[model samples]
Target: MQIQGLHHAQITIPKGREQEGRQFYCELLGLEEMEKPEALKGRGGFWLHAGNLQVHVGTEDGDARSATKAHLAYEVTGLEAWKETLRAQGLVPEESVPVPGMERFEFRDPFGNRVELLEVTEDPSL
Candidate 1:
């Protein structure tokens, strides 16, 4: 059987730092917060409405996040504007490796999670 698409993705923040996570993911990033299920409400962290999918930020011991290359890359429009927006907040966007027909950059969230924003420069077909 063919697989379906992603339902959600999860990232972690240091335990007891949920407010910081919310500030970065919500206030700065512009993702809207979603209510957690009752059974999951007691757990730390929150969910975000990201396009059609959800991003679940869970709380845990997040000491090693910056040491890994694992990250989330979001497809967006107006790449240059995004870069400026990030810079305005004192966040530097690092140039990413070249990928045909795409312009992109990455930056670490306050909690060290690598977040990428990319825009299609040409038809995506290869």
Candidate 2:
């Protein structure tokens, strides 16, 4: 059997802190906000569209903690420009090791969630 692409990614935020999640994911990250289904609206969360990926934030039952094991990565066209944009928003972008064949950088979301910005090389074999 073959699996298709990702349908959505879910991140858990502390209960009653949906607003904080919104500020970081939406306001800081510049992800376009999308409305969630009516049935899931009462669940306390927000949906965002990141390119072809859908990011969903759900409220966790307890305290919020950093997601150190997993992270979401985005491929951008202009790496330097995007890095500057993030810096202007008061977010620091850290230089990351060259992925075997990709140029990438890493940064943390307002909630300390790790994210990577990669620029695909013309020749991926590089």
Candidate 3:
């Protein structure tokens, strides 16, 4: 058996904090927000896309904890411009990430979820 690529990744934010999710994920990060399916519309969250990848931002209590170590890496274009934009918002990333195949840096969202923006220059699948 083989596992395919990811279907989606979920992150939690406090209830009534979806607006901040919108500000960071949509407005600041440039992810395109999409309508959640009808069956899940009332659950109090939203979906976003970067390329074909889905990130589900869900609502929960303020006690929702974020991992300080793990994060999601999204392949990006115009990475230098992103650095400037994030810096302007006081969301600076640590740019000295020394991954051999990826030029990447990581930052935290408003809800404290860690995320990495990477430009992969090599095919690891080879």
Candidate 4:
């Protein structure tokens, strides 16, 4: 048997700072907050669903550095509209880059988390 797909993803936020995480991931990014399992709630974490993947944010012991190198990429249909929406929320969207087979733009979340928005187009050679 082979691995099918990713079930969940976890991001670390400093202890007692989940509000900031919620503001960015939930409010700004438009992800809906979901309740964590009762067993895992004691650890202080929240879950959100994106498409079919689950994103988990857990509180860490101390001041944790932001993950700039790693990022979550989201594919959207209305790329321009999304860019405008981000700008209206005071989040700047960088110019789209040609990724050989896709179009993408990079933006940072309120917590300085790097995220990429991508839209795939029909291959010219197809």
Candidate 5:
């Protein structure tokens, strides 16, 4: 068997700072917060759902450092709209990454997690 697609992307947040997550992921990013399972209810953090894609923010030791090398990439339809939303929240896209066949940019979450928004265009050879 082979893997079909990515299930979720787990990001880290400082302990007891889940409300920040709600503000950023839910309020700003427009992701819906889902209830944690019964078994995992005691654990810290929250779950966000964008359609079928999931983003899990878990609590961790407080650190000044932010995620640099690792990041999550999301496929989006309204790229310009998303950028405007990010700017409206004062979380402007850091820099637009140049990919030959794609339009994309990177932005940091409130907790300092890097997320890439991508828009793929049709291939010439159809």
Candidate 6:
């Protein structure tokens, strides 16, 4: 199975500064704010459209961006096949927080950066 492309990349801002994050990314950068999933609404963060992909801005207590839970999400065609592939490579994939219409897992890369593989089961925007 092949990865289709990047679905989204995440970055984090300091906790309780969501409004500043929105003003910077949405107003200054001109990215349209996208609705976060209903289940995730209470989580203090936001999502933005960046051309064909998305950028998810989350909150963190303190640290450099990479030290937080920021990650890159890649869209893949085969959900189960990817799990098998990662397992064969000896990497344990951790189940992600459930998002409606998507199946996903996260694993740390060799250098310790978080990477997520996701397959869309339905159009989440619908």
Task: Write down the lDDT of every candidate, Cα atoms only.
Answer: 0.90, 0.81, 0.83, 0.79, 0.82, 0.75
For model 6, the run of ten residues with the poorest summed lDDT: 107-116
Cα shift from native, residue 32, model 3 (Å) = 1.1
Per-prediction TM-score: 0.93, 0.80, 0.86, 0.79, 0.83, 0.51
TM-score-based ranking: 1, 3, 5, 2, 4, 6
Model 1, 12-62: lDDT tens digits are: 999899998888888988899999999998888899998999999999884
Candidate that scores best on lDDT: 1
Angstrom error at residue 118, model 5: 1.3
lDDT value for model 1: 0.90
- In terms of TM-score, the best-performing candidate is 1
lDDT of 5 by residue, 3-118 (tens): 99988878888889988889888887678999889898678999989778888888988654363768878888898899999998888686675877788899887777778988
Off by over 4 Å in 5: 64-67, 123-125
lDDT by residue for model 4 (1-126), tens:
999999988877777778888887888678989888889888886999988999888777642335456877887778888889899988889865577777789887765667889887766587
> On TM-score, who's better, 2 or 6?
2
1 or 6, which is superior by lDDT? 1
Q: Write the per-residue lDDT of candidate 3 for residues 1-126, one digit (tens) a residue.
A: 999998898888888988888998899888999889999989998999878889888998864356566677888988878888998999868875587877888887777778889887788786
- Count of backbone collisions in candidate 1: 0
Q: What would the per-residue lDDT of candidate 6 be over residues 63-124, giving only the tens digit for each residue?
A: 55546476777677787887787687676789999998999998764334467888899987
Query: Candidate 1: TM-score?
Result: 0.93
lDDT of 4 at 111: 59
Clashing pairs in 3: none
lDDT of 6: 0.75
